[model samples]
Target: MNARREGDAAVQSYRRAQQRLRDGGKDVSSEQRLIRIEDALDALLDGLVKQREQIGSGVAVDVAGHTLAARARSRR
Candidate 1:
């Protein structure tokens, strides 16, 4: 799955977990779990933004040991 799709899934998971906690009443452990989920979501979103920016700017992007660029420059 793509980053965007993964991010969406993460959001849905977080919402479901949050709703469950709310229905069951909050506890220390559950709150901690929620915090961790939120942190993961934030990190995923941040990574997506960075990837989009890199792609838009035509910068070289490293993926699995290979570099991809929008337009290759000729060697001088």
Candidate 2:
């Protein structure tokens, strides 16, 4: 999937998980629940990392192109 899709899916899943936990009240303190929360958090982080990587790559490319153009103009 694309970066935005992946990011949106991650956010939705995290929100669902959080809601489930909130609804669980005092009965969802099992190890499984903790594991689920941890997994959700990890997925959220992974999505954020992917989005940031895509953004950073684009910014870097733009900056490099601008620098090259500036140098070429100076040489002319």
Candidate 3:
């Protein structure tokens, strides 16, 4: 998906996760919430990368590597 759509999805996911926490919802466990949050973060980062590319920015971001590192840190 394009940056805009991806960003929108990420925003929605983030809101959902936050709402769950605020409402004290127990349908999803902490681990599941962490995964959802990570997924949303990845999507947001992907959108940023795409936006940079579209704007012809000289900067480059390794989304996959960053995400891998984050996941590793989370597991530790």
Candidate 4:
């Protein structure tokens, strides 16, 4: 799917997650909320990555990999 469509889906997913935490009788705690946010963000990232791949845009992935390798080498 296109980036806009993927983004829309991610937004919908985020709303659903928020609703789950806010629904009546829900027992989600602050820590769980944070985890949910992280999970949502990861899902959004994955969607974005897929969109980039579909569009044949590899610059972002290449740049991320280069930065990651540089950071890893610096730590070694």
Q: Which candidate leads in TM-score? A: 2
lDDT of each: 0.53, 0.67, 0.58, 0.63
Model 4 lDDT tens row, 1-76: 3445655665666566566445444477777877767776666566566555544435555677899999999999
The candidate that wins on lDDT is 2
Model 2 spans with C-alpha error above 4 angstroms: 1-29
Residue-pair clashes per candidate: 0, 0, 0, 0
Candidate 3 TM-score, C-alpha based: 0.42
Q: Which of the two candidates, 1 or 3, achieves a greater lDDT against the reference?
A: 3
Of 1 and 2, the candidate ranking higher by TM-score: 2
In angstroms, the error of model 1 at 49 is: 0.3
| Deviation in Å, model 4, residue 55 alpha carbon | 0.4
Candidate ranking under lDDT, highest first, comes to: 2, 4, 3, 1
Per-residue lDDT tens digits for candidate 3, residues 22-52, read 5535697888877766766665566565555
lDDT, model 4, position 17: 57
Superposed on all Cα atoms, model 2 deviates from the true structure by an RMSD in Å of: 4.1
What is the per-residue lDDT of model 1 for residues 1-76, given as tens digits with 9 covering 90 to 100?
3555545655665565555444533455767767766766665666566556545444332453243232333332
The residue pairs in collision within model 2 are: none
Model 1 stretches astray by more than 4 angstroms: 1-28, 59-76
lDDT tens digits, residue span 1-76, model 2 = 3545545665666676566555555666688678777776775666567667657666777898999999999999
Candidate 3 or 1, higher TM-score: 3
Output the better candidate (3/4) by lDDT. 4
